[model samples]
Target chain A: MLSKKQARAFFLGGTLVTFLIFIGLTIFSLSKDVDQTNHENITEAVVRGKDLWDHNNCMGCHTLLGEGGYYAPELTKVIDRRGRPYIKAVLMSKVPWQPNGRKMVAYGFTNEQAEDLIAFFDWIDDIDLNGFDRVVSPLAKDKTN
Target chain B: MTLYKGKRRTTTALVLSMGLFFAALLYLPGMLPFDSQVTDSFFRWWVVHLWVEGVWELIMGGILSFLLIKLTGVDREVIEKWLYVIVGLTFLSGVLGTGHHYYYIGVNKIWLIVGGIFSALEPLAFLAMALFAVNMYRKGEKKHPNKLALYWTLGAAIVSFVGAGLLGFAHTLPQTNLYTHGTLVTAMHGHLAFWGAYAMIVLAIISYAMPNMTGRKLYDTGRGRMAFWFSNVGMVGMTVAFGVAGVAQVYMERIMKIEFMKVQEMMEIHFYILIICATLFTTGILMYIADFIKHGQPTDEALIKE
Candidate 1:
């Protein structure tokens, strides 16, 4: 039995309230006091690495922080699971890196660019993922065990 | 501006405009650097999570309402009123439902509780949508001869409820998502959700508009009807394939603690099935395009009646 006027009121009112609360929560969570991302460690190399990650659309296959195409492995704890040298070799390799039959596009990154991506991975490996790090890469857990 | 020139401003316009505003807001989170994973991931949901679940639902509701009004010959006042209620339910549940993505992304524990409760309610909006569409069809005195369009319109509502509502609810909770978060399971839910909700609605509109614009009443053709069934059945088959592969991956990778690559290799068969189903889906789409080509360019003669 709701009239159009009342229904419109409900829509506008509900939207306004929820939007404000969402903004408030965003501000609260991102505030420095509750920070869990190790924000201070983002160096120039890490920024460049992120640029490379985005530019190459690495997320087209690989997942970082449990977010990406599921076509590739979860790279949230990649540095811990696979050593830097192995990752570097893959990046610097002229041909595609086919580990278990899945082919990865070979960027043939220079040493410095590879190092920057490694730094980015290293930085990512350190973020507090609310225990998702433990869940995503069991190899890290095995190492600790 | 020209579209709205002589027409009185309606609720559909207002809701759709609001959806556009939210779409523009999707850019805000992307401008921030990935400097802080917590902040970056947190705000990233403002785009990713908000779009499909939040404002996009508003857009869907608006379009669904418009379609129901036209296809069912329902009263504008009644349809608009329900549209308001549906949009209300969407924002009420969906805004806080953003917390679901925040559960494991290094945010506070408050999100676990907030996201769990709110996202559980998110299905209600879709349920309301399905009910609204059906009820409007029943109440309608006029049956628009465009049965193909009607099928798509109703299909969008019902399928969205199942794909976006039920399937999304299946893995939305923090406890289940913890195990399934990054696995192929997310892909399973995502494919059907997008196909049913956004993709089907867009197809519905296209189906409705094509004949009117081209002056070709092709809705009764076997090809048109076949396009609907084949595409929908193919999509469902693909969803099952992905679901099977995803569940196997979650069990092997997350629970058994198998290495990611080994688990992926174990699930290669599902990808084959996915490819097969994808071929079926592609065939349907190609047929639809062929039909569209047959409709030819819209002539001024068709527009003259308007």
Candidate 2:
């Protein structure tokens, strides 16, 4: 049997070798699958959509991807849930608060700005997000603690 | 024994404080839906800032300094004052800098400016403590075969302070914070700063304390390096992805004026990067756990066979 020091060395060394192999595999796997649909313009449009989210401070009312304020819908996959015109109509709806006590107060937008918002939403809908949905229910953090 | 007694008392208090803070974190999320922007921000500072800067940091510095004193046979008096200074400065600057988190809460711009500048001073204290630890290590050469654990402890100190404190300053200024807050850039900082400060320090303490707790010859050089690489590399991956996604959000929101829902959809792709990094990070933690569980060879004379 090996000494304590020698056995310690063996386990540590074994772990290192395995970790290095894992690292190599991770890099190799990531490089092989470049999705062709991830084009430049579409990518840029997606980027613009994110900027819009932050500037508006949507987290004030809405939850997205399990992060953010919980007063509004989870919006990680809003495109799948709602249609293009529906999204545009909602943004431009001029009706500002359907009254019965919803926490979200709407911002009045011109029809053209609303259309731009729709275009942004449609672009997001087109991107592949690997199947996360935007639904508003209590999150894991809510249910567990 | 008196010195050890004092150290033990301090450590126990620190542990209690940490446990309380974690309990608070577990409870705070439930407070949402009733969560006001300001109230939530208030608790965020209390949980994240106070723990790292105010309490756990002071505790860690004290415990490590005490260990150094014992290990190096240095007079504990000489180290105690320096430890106090480090801990004191960390708490003072950290608490006042709680104002930095106030920017989004509709606090005055002046508080943000002052908090940003004062928070910048935290890293200098870390740098001095790091230098002192290195100098102490250099003084005590070839003392024990297990001296390597001290080096790991020092590395944890350096990187934790750098990732949590130094890089923290990079995006903390008002201009950068404007673009980054509530974005993936903010998420990146949360990941690195918290993991580096909290996780690495815990690992270092485990490496130091486990041998005594288990009564085994517990130091393993190879596994330590593997854990270190996996964590640090995965952190780098997460940080880069977060940065890219943050910049992307900035372009989309400020420049392109895309709607909020659409921006979120675009940001989903960034989750793939985080998922991969999480896998590597989890693997690293598992390997460390394995090393701890199966500690010593059964037949070794140096180990007390259970």
Candidate 3:
């Protein structure tokens, strides 16, 4: 029952407003939850490590910032799960490092390269990811939720 | 007549797109309990899964229905009937199919059952669209002069079936998604679905409407055909590259348990291929835009008289 002009105006305006609000609200909520308090230790080594990770395209096989390939486990908390020395050793060796049944691809990282990536991993570990795997079901006796 | 069609379809699509977007907005605040990454993840999937899989389909349905009615020279009632079927199938499955993203998002274990079963039915809607478009094209006795529009319309329906339906079903089961959810495998499906279902329909509408709007008949030009073929072939090439890289990534990283970065290093060649294909796709879009500009501004006198 609306005129064409009115309809067009309402349609475009409504969509634009809705999209803007959705994005704004999501960003606001995400900002409140960001826990990057570990910024002090984000040195040049960590930056280089991040650069090297992007350069080699590690995300093609691993998850980082929850945005990459999920073939391998998430590297967001990898440093915590596996110690720095363990990660370094795994990188330095060229053999297929089998974390499970799958043989891990070896990239032949030198000690320095390994240390830099480990440092990047170390820096990432300090940020709070809010416990991605903590059980929160009502059925659990001590529900984290 | 053309102005009426553009405003009507644009208005309808905009309304539908906003409706779902707003629904997701209302649903998002409750998901803000950032203490549990599990909780954050549970709600994050709601917005993404609901938009792409749910309401966006309605937008595509509206545009496709309009295009079919115009391009096929079919009676509006006939096209509207099939439109109803498409909308019905889409909502019936798509609303519940959102459960597909629920598996392992820290929701209740009930999701494992519901998500798997419902998502299995999702491809039916896309298949219906493919059949519907092809049938309409066949039934229309008179050939529409705009061959490029016809090509894109048919391409939208058929390719969407392969990308959003068959390719989507390739790894949609809970069992497969458990392994392929965030991997490059998902990327392959995502790229094709967006291109085929959404992007193609957009191009189809533009192709159909542009000449009519500007009082120009440029459909037979080689550039128009080149744009269509180049973009379509480029997109298919990109999908294949993503697919090949994804399969190898799953094997190397998940099955072979290669260190993640090493597997990525091995797969860098595929990314190069993706870039090259993307460039080709961009070039085709630029060519299409060039034709669009050459058509000149629309004047009221330019409107075609029946």
Candidate order by decreasing DockQ: 1, 3, 2
Candidate 1 residue lDDT tens string, B1-306: 633683778888778878878888886877777565557677778888889887888889888888999999989999999999998999889999999899887777778888999999999999999999999999999889998889989999999998889989999999899888888888888888899889999988898898987886667679988898889999999999989998999899988889888988888899999999999998888888887887757767666745
Residue A91 lDDT, candidate 3, scale 0-100: 83
TM-scores for every candidate against the unseen true structure: 0.95, 0.60, 0.67
Model 2 docking tier (incorrect/acceptable/medium/high): incorrect
Better of 2 and 3 by TM-score: 3
DockQ of candidate 3 against the true complex: 0.08
The residue-by-residue lDDT of candidate 2 on B65-172, one tens digit each, is: 755765565555555545655554565466556556655443334446656776777676566667667766677543544543565567666766666677777777
Question: Tens digit of lDDT per residue, candidate 3, span A1-145?
Answer: 4344553454345435544553453343334343233545668887778777877888777765444665566766576556778888888888888765556777889888899899887766555433322211111112334
TM-score of 1: 0.95
Q: Candidate 1, what DockQ?
A: 0.68
Instruction: Please give the TM-score for the first chain of candidate 1.
Output: 0.95
lDDT of 3 by residue, B173-243 (tens): 87676666557888899888999988988989998888876887757778888998888888889999999
- Candidate 1 reference-contact recovery: 0.64
**Quality class of the docking in candidate 3, CAPRI style:** incorrect
Per-residue error (Å), model 3, residue A2: 31
| lDDT tens per residue, model 2, A14-80 | 4355335433532332242532123333444444545455567876776543347633454544655
* DockQ in order: 0.68, 0.02, 0.08
Clashes of each: 0, 7, 11
Q: What TM-score does model 3 achieve against the real structure?
A: 0.67
